[model samples]
Target: MNTATGEIHELWEIREEDDPRRSYAFGGRHGQFSFARIMAMLAKDSGITGDDFRVFFYCGIMTYEEGGATAKEAAEFLGLTPQATRRITKKLAEHKMLLVAEIIGRTIKYRASPHIISALSGRQQSEQAAAFHLPTLPGRSGSATKGRTNDTSRPVPRTHRPAGTDERTAAPETEHTDDVRDPGRPGARRRTHRG
Candidate 1:
């Protein structure tokens, strides 16, 4: 299974559950744009980490579905502190990936940038979108078509085994024994022997 090419072949055909409910498939153009292109773009961008990409994607989706999203709302959705969310938003804003849509009193609303929206809409990649080159991460050669493999044939170092465990033997039994004390019973104090 090569992850680089993203080509997958299901060897065994699994029968679907006998539920009468209809399953929805979000794919074709939109799915490719959202999951494939946008995610890769976000991952490659030096300014955005994986977490930052998640927050950004959430913000974009929320904005598209529910008009707009605030930093507090984004923080709540991402389970992050408001300050942390603000920092992510600030970075996105600096990179022109996020746009301030409106400001009502103290609350500031944000939406995905025009470039992002255009790209996600299946339009040609804008100059801003093309600027980000996919990073050459470890174990990956930055070639999307190439399948990832263990390039180095170096043997993995062995570590010391824990006490009472042998590599050749099966794991120790977890069954109850006479020496084991039952803590669930009333007055089940362990007797400390005075040596």
Candidate 2:
């Protein structure tokens, strides 16, 4: 239900009831546990340290708006010194976890990337497919074949070289030696056949 104040109801009370802390609760795991955990993990992975995640969680997850608080406002809401909030906001910005935009005044707002949100919400399955290797897309020159062969028979594109230049001149040749090659300097050159 939309409150008379125009705030849309979200699952679980966001803050203390009837205290104007902007808290509302709808009972369910979706609101209370899952969403909160998503926010917490996003904050952590995005490089928000200290108790900044707490402030970020409250402001970002509860408000339902990417533009929740300026650094000064966050400091006030979190009861932190302004300097502390500034430092935290700076770090968040450095890590690309927060976005700073200028409206009427310079406004600092934070939100998890859409990629993170989609993965967290189960709307995107690719993020969870890390355990399995996906076959390369059709018509693409994938590296190997089903028989565990190198598939060197397949033709691959060669780099274009300028006039009077050969493959060796276009790309540096490397020599494999039983003796250790000093990586600090250039090594000797060796030749191999190309088709």
Candidate 3:
């Protein structure tokens, strides 16, 4: 503390290497997720449970990083029985959130839908999409503008802007939006809402 005036200081070294507000893993990059599908999967009407979410994302993580995996391998890491893993994978596949890629011996490999989770860059995903002949996945429901009819979004109050983004002159608040690609699905046409 300064004896003459009250002040607080923090060191540059104190900054966190990874931003805690966003999710990142071994690659130190943001992992993509489909807002529409995620909300749908978690909705009461979707019949997906927390366990389903776990298993689905686990397969995506493995697929994004290591191509793909069998239920047995995922089970070992996720601490579930191989049977349970298989069942979850089956359910997720039926939901179109996962796919049966291939089989080697008696094990079936699974890949997550590009709309759900992806680690590949947009171009990489595009190549995989063509090679895999994967269908372009639907993102948010309805047309871009049509979906926002309820206007669930609210403009950020001026007082709450992030530290580095403060503006000097008064400006009108507009709906701030960003479009994130649906992994490898090249033809996706919906806009995702972000705060």
Candidate 4:
């Protein structure tokens, strides 16, 4: 069965002889939980800090209501300052572990990395493996740098060169040959001279 939040409400019927060694419930557990274990492994492998792990888990779980939540919202939910939330989100984005799914004037919505989502949903190595292999999110193609486009197939427009400069005339006279000597330096030796 699934909860109203869409998460599977995993159930295990207890039998007299069956002593459950571990519990996967959300609360009331005295020891480490499965989610915590997953986060620990993710943190160690990805070099993310404890705070980052907390923020990441919060975002991953709370994002069910909306496609994603803004940093301010996440901060409020996690009881962290907005600046701290921004810093953590920025780091996660730089590492490609979080993506900006949407942007409104001053608000940006974030989504977990596809790999992280797959892992958390217990589908990391199963029939739904295709979801784990998705490419990094869009808007990361480097097309916005200095107003340039990333489409290399389109030819770039050429600006008119100065009167004295052209493909043939732009090169210096010494550039036509293979000589590596610098003639402008007075103390420089000719290529055929003694060492």
Best by TM-score: 3
Model 2: pairs clashing at backbone N, Cα or C within 3 Å:
11-26, 12-25, 12-26, 13-24, 13-25, 14-24, 15-23
Model 1 has an lDDT value of 0.60
* TM-score to native of every candidate shown: 0.43, 0.35, 0.50, 0.43
Q: Write the per-residue lDDT of candidate 2 for residues 34-67, one digit (tens) a residue.
A: 3653454445343345565665455445334443
lDDT of 4 by residue, 1-195 (tens): 555668767687766666746767666322212454354435444456677878877676654546677789889988999999998886666555566779899788887655555333444334433543332222344322223433335544465677867657455445434445667997464555445
Local error of candidate 4 at residue 93 (angstroms): 1.3
Candidate 4: residue 31 Cα off by (Å):
21
Instruction: List candidate 2 segments past 4 Å from native.
Output: 1-48, 62-66, 101-103, 116-195
**Clash count, candidate 3:** 0
CA-RMSD of model 1: 22.4
Query: 46-105, model 1: which lDDT tens digit per residue?
Result: 445776777777777766676668889998988999998888776565455667778899
Clashes found in each candidate (C-alpha, N, C closer than 3 A): 0, 7, 0, 0
lDDT for 22 in candidate 1 is 62
TM-score, structure 3 vs. true: 0.50
Better of 1 and 4 by lDDT: 1
Give me the candidate number with maximum lDDT: 3
Q: Per-residue lDDT tens digits of candidate 3, residues 1-195?
A: 666787766655455768545643556545667687677777775556777778888888878677777888888988999888898886566445677878888778998887567777888766655654232222334312211222236553343676778668778555435655566798564587656
